[model samples]
Target: MKTESSAELTLRGTKTESRVELTLRGLVLGVVLTVVFTAANVYFGLKAGLTFSTSIPAVVISMAMLRWLGNTSAQENNIVQTVASTAGTLSSIIFVLPGFIMIGWWSGFPYWQSVAICATGGILGVMYSIPLRRALVTDSDLPYPEGTACAEVIKVGSGDVADKDSVESSGKGLKAVLVGSLVSALFLVMVQARLFLGDVAHSFRL
Candidate 1:
């Protein structure tokens, strides 16, 4: 038997053309996640000068939500993650554009200006990335670590694995998620209560 290529495996074993993949519920969930992740990215970018990728978290959240709904599918979760990741990535613009207003370059981020800048940048990015997708994702031997990890997540959550392995994996994933969530919640509480210094030190005093 011939082994399936990565591209083929990526496309196969899932419903690629199902209407459920683009349902109103899924779109709404995606939009909600997009907003949440975008806000989180903006906060972290401004505070730490860094932003985490929303792809993995979006995938896991989408999978959990769909699983709870009892009609989970890989395609639907993929769509949710795609939408959320796009919105989260666009939040990076917040890091640069606001500085212009602060330094007397622009009075403020005007509605039309912000829209135009984001739209143009997004379109140009998509245009440039098409070739890069072919070269890097399809042709190159480079290990796309994040993409590989996301694929593994999707596969594990796809429910195509053997029952025993699936149960074991799911249990571990749940435990990890719970621990992470608790830690994050605790950190947020500490910051809110001023129990921990969440912001960076701007000055040193003897």
Candidate 2:
């Protein structure tokens, strides 16, 4: 199947309109996901000294939620994930900033100062990165693994099922996702329970 480019989709009026992409429902869902992911990231970072990317999980959750809500579209789901992932990333500030307090740099986190620091740093990063967008994303042939995976999820979730084969294919895809999720969950449980060695090297001593 041929994929539509942004310009082509716009010309064909197939792209999502601004109103649809910025609906109240989508924003509300984004805010909810952002809060949950941010809190989870903060807790994980504090305890484990690390946090995983939230983009894939946010995208999957957004797609599933929007699909269940009905009348929602892929662009709306994208918007929701964008908002959520931003919050997830920003939560990393909690990882380092608290060290200042622990080291007696401050008695507590200053609300306005923290906001100012984060906002300024984010703005500067965005400004500096804007010039490299084309070179990094468009000109380069780099495989953006996370981005590609999220796009695949969107494509599968948004596929039209006007025919029997398409319906069957979508069903298979859904089953694959469900099975993968279950397998992952089982592996995590085994690791947590110490039933499975998380690191083979450690278990076998190289």
Candidate 3:
């Protein structure tokens, strides 16, 4: 029975050509894009003294280009955008929130303690999702839009499709890389060496 079931599974998976291929491509591109997007966000975060939220935007733009080139499906684009956006928001919260305690923008919590709790919550979220995978993907007819998009991305990468029209702007990724690096470096320097500000003191009363 088990062997028969395994064979059935293999047969089912083989029937989907584009979906599997695209998903693999998406995963590969997703990793590369995540790094690039995170760096850009961090850089802009420092420069503007606020979070830039680049992850979603970057993914959307990249996927939109892919779709325009007929390399990705609408569902695939949606998935990448959702994942990227969530990552961007999470990254911003993780990176910036703890600093609030050190600077006294918030009170009644230790910075390290809050950081630990936040980190734990992030981990738990991932853990919680594992049990639901079957429910989300296998148990019902709910479409896995993000999963489908990832598959499409994989397919495109594996197929080695060329962008013949070259509609995408050149040097955009390079600009993001350069700016992000410079800003993050400067922010680190200032934070570590205390170049700009001292231990600011404050007292607030209601």
Q: Which candidate achieves the best lDDT against the true structure?
A: 1
lDDT by residue for model 1 (1-206), tens: 22433533653565444436677777898999889888878887987898889888887777766776776677777778778888667989987798888899898778898989889998998999998776666666666677667766776677765546744665566567769879988999999999998767577789
Minimum summed lDDT over a 10-residue window in model 3 is located at 1-10
* TM-score comparison, 2 vs 3, better candidate: 2
Off by over 4 Å in 1: 1-20, 102-104, 164-190, 193-206
Ordered from best to worst lDDT, the candidate numbers read 1, 2, 3
Candidate 3 global lDDT: 0.53
Q: What is the lDDT of residue 81 in candidate 2?
A: 72
Residue 98 accuracy (lDDT) in model 3: 54
Please count the clashing residue pairs in each candidate, in the order shown.
0, 0, 16
For candidate 2, the per-residue lDDT at 107 reads 92
Q: Which of candidates 2 and 3 is the stronger one according to lDDT?
A: 2
Give me the runs in candidate 3 sitting further than 4 Å from their true place.
1-22, 64-71, 94-119, 126-206
Clashing pairs in 1: none
Residue 59 Cα positional deviation in candidate 2, in Å, after optimal superposition: 1.7
